[model samples]
Target: MNKTRILDVKYALTQILYFASFSALMGYASVYLLGQGVSNSLIGTTLALVSIIAVFTQPMAASAVDKKVIKLQSLVNIILIGTVILSLCLYFFELPTMMLLCVFVGIVTFMMTVQPLFNSMAFLFEKYGIQINYGLARGLGSAAYALASAVLGYLVEDFGTGVIPLFYIIGNILLIIVVYTYVVPKNQQHLVQHEQQNKEETEQKQLSFFQFCALYKKFMIFVVGVVLVFFTHTIINNFFIQVITPIGGTESQMGIAVFIAAIVELPAMAMFNIMRKKINCARLLKLSVVMFALKHLLTFLATNIFMIYVAQVLQIGAYAIFIPASVYYVNEVISKQDLVKGQSMVTVGITASGIIANFAGGILLDAVGVYHLLMIGVVVSVVGGLIVFGSIEKKKANVME
Candidate 1:
């Protein structure tokens, strides 16, 4: 294989491990916590608090990278080191069930904090003259998530949630090794991504998010849309065990549902670039946002486990297209220097939506019931989809070329 192809493989491996590790937290952490006797409301509170912290930490880390205070690799390494240490603690130490949840919260927070960096890693290789197959890599990453959730469903069923820590430990260890092993071609190693206008001026300017929002009004609109649309999906992902409960789904069935969702995402995400060739990204993004509502509506109306699985099949039109489209939309709207901030802002919006879902979804589940929650999700998802549909801009959307 050529050098770029080799880098592509390594990059894909890193994505595989990263998503596999994090899927444990998103897919099964609630199951594990509930197994440990953590109350539903308390589990939601844990996720809320962690997401609130991530809201601030992601921007700070992004600013540090912008100022060149730390390289992306080093920052990712630090987060991974902390994650491994925390996961080990969760595994070896028998703490109060609350403390175990706390440790798991730490791992989740670290994973959330580092995700934008992982996304940014693709652009990092552009400096080395190797354009990694990001869509293909991400598609495979989702496949890994599918496989992991499938196996973990049974493992947690047979062995216990102890396997959560094992997944984290093994996945991160492989990730750390793979992250550093990608080859940088000697010819492009020292190339600067862009020429500077004035080093002093750029260094003095702070990374102000509000400024970007003010200058780019549509971006703020986009952020709000993202928050709204993500609210139900984030809840579904985090509390999936609960999501399928109303339909009499088992952990194995939940795994199958999740596996179907992630597996279906592969082709849509991998083919995103080709899809862009045939259709404007704005149209695709709008369609995907609308599909988000449709997917939830199906889930809301599902009366059987099979119905729920059919709902999972909608992942192709929903998140699969939205993921790559959002990236393209942000790149189109935001300046190159502010791109990380733009991406971080998107993450913050999703996290903020997650914060709402975690805080409310739990208490709501405890107070009301799962189907009632689904009713609310159905209503809000439609509202969110409308907002997002309006938020997409057609002007300059064709600039992907």
Candidate 2:
């Protein structure tokens, strides 16, 4: 194969492994915690702690990459090594509550940072003239997530929740191999050249963090809208097992629900490039926000497990489009020098949403029940969608004026 084809294949394979590893670590975290005798409130607290760590660490990770304090490959290596070590530790050794909490925090910190860092690398590669079929690769990643969730569901059923750490170790090990063996050599030259170019461009005065925030006020608004939407999204995601259990769904069925949610994204993500040619990213994002509200409404109204399955189908309009669209929107709106920071800002929004969701979803699920919690999601999603719509409209009006 030619170099481009080879690079494309490697990138795609890397995405599959990357997201599969993520799925293995995070997809069933709540269920595994519950199985370990942790209460729902404690599980939520754990997740909130993870999010708090992410809030601080994600920006540091992005800044490190942006400033060349660590190369992308080096960062990936560090994360993979940490993940493997932690997974092995968790699997082979039983620890106290504090120790387990520390391990969980470490694992989440690495996983949360990986997505944005890898995404920034993809953007850098594209800027360097590498033809990455990002949508197709991302779709494959979603498929891998679905497959992993299904397999993990079965494994959890048969072997117990202890299987979680085993899968984490295996997935990260494979990811390490893929990075060292396949991805590194293919893209090293481009990355080096891109770094050199960035160095040359860095002679200009860099904006202070406060100044940067001031300058991107509009973009910040968009980020706030994203925060609101994901607030609801995270609640649904974290509490989904609870939602279906009342309707007689087992672990396997929960896996199927996750699979359904993930698989439906494939077509939408695969077609993202084609769709972007027709609809602009801003409008696409607005539409996604609307769909997100609809999805929450449907989920809130779901009476049985099948209804929840049907609701998962709406993942196409919600996350499938949102992912690619967010990437494009940020790339187009943010300058090259601030690209990593910009992506990190988006990650911050997501993590913040997750923090709120975990804390609130956990408490509410315990206090009022799943239906009431879902109704809260419905209300929040609608408000979020309207906020995005208004923001987009105002931006357009300002441009016209």
Candidate 3:
């Protein structure tokens, strides 16, 4: 057993545990809360608050990691531990609506804000001279999410929503155990010093935030397209029950639908390496944006529960390709010095859209209905795809030309 194989397995385990925790909380919190007597409008509002808080806090946390205030793995462990404690808090105590919402928001926000850190950890062990297969690990993470969804649906059905926090506690604890077990036998103190020194050197040469914006205005436009395109994703994911309820889908079916959606992602990702042999990444990125619009169009036209599944199958072309393609896009276009923030801009675009969609989806559902919201999603996503298509037509220097 080679070191790479060992690290890959460890990372895959970590991803599985982390994503399963995500599924139990974020994926089904609406169902859980509704069972607890929370309203749909308030549910959406609560989720929006999670994204809102994350938008402000995640950067500060990331900056702390950047400045070496904390090590990445150590920070992740601390968060996982914090999540477990909060999950237990939710498990043991029954609270009033306001307090329950506040506590629930904290649990989800902690899990959600730490998402990028998990991705970055895929490359963390590279400093140890061994790189894990990130794509493989990420695909397995999807598998974990899919399994968790189906099982949680059953659990919510039979055991009631009370089991939600129990799952949260279990998942986070397992993740913590995994984190501590994956030890880098190399000199930890030496690596810490090396990392801090590199960060300090990078800090000295780092461009001002305004300059990064000015120099990469084209990428900023690209981020706009990301936020718009992701608005469609946010609606479908966060407001999934609303999408299906009018057509008579239940929690179990919603779980299955989510399962189908997530299960397909892994195979799509697995085939990406082969797909790259036939299609260049830039074209794939544009096609993915177009495919995102197509998915929204299908969702809009869906009148039956079966049609919803059909729309989910479209993830094969949309998100599955976009994830890897966007990473390549940043590397190809952005300077190395700005690469970290460049990736962050793309993530921030998604989070920003999440805030908008979450806040709006609840209101729209309360005011109009699901179909009206789906129609808006279809139109908005189509325009978003166009912006992405045009935004990446040339590199930054030639955009005006």
| TM-score on alpha carbons, each prediction | 0.86, 0.84, 0.89
lDDT of 1 by residue, 53-138 (tens): 88888768766765667766778888898899998898888789778877888898899888878776787686555688887787
Question: Which parts of model 3 have CA positions greater than 4 angstroms off?
Answer: 1-7, 62-73, 189-193, 196-206, 395-401
Clashing pairs in 1: none
RMSD (CA, angstroms), candidate 3: 3.1
Candidate that would win on lDDT: 3
RMSD of each: 3.6, 3.9, 3.1
What ranges in model 1 sit over 4 Å off?
Answer: 1-5, 62-72, 180-219, 330-345, 396-401
Q: lDDT per residue, candidate 3, 243-341, as tens digits?
A: 888888878878888998899888778888798778877799998988889889988888888998898888889998999888777877887767777
lDDT of 2 by residue, 1-401 (tens): 38768878877888898888788677788877777677777777788888887777776876676666777778877888997898788888888867876887788778877777677667666766777888778878989999988888888899988888898788788878776754444446456646755764673356666777897887887778888889889987776678778777777878888999999988888788899889988899888998898888888887778887888898899998898888777777777667666777887788788998898888888889888888888888887777777665322322211
User: Judged by lDDT against the true structure, how good is candidate 1?
Assistant: 0.81
300 Cα displacement, candidate 2 (Å): 1.6
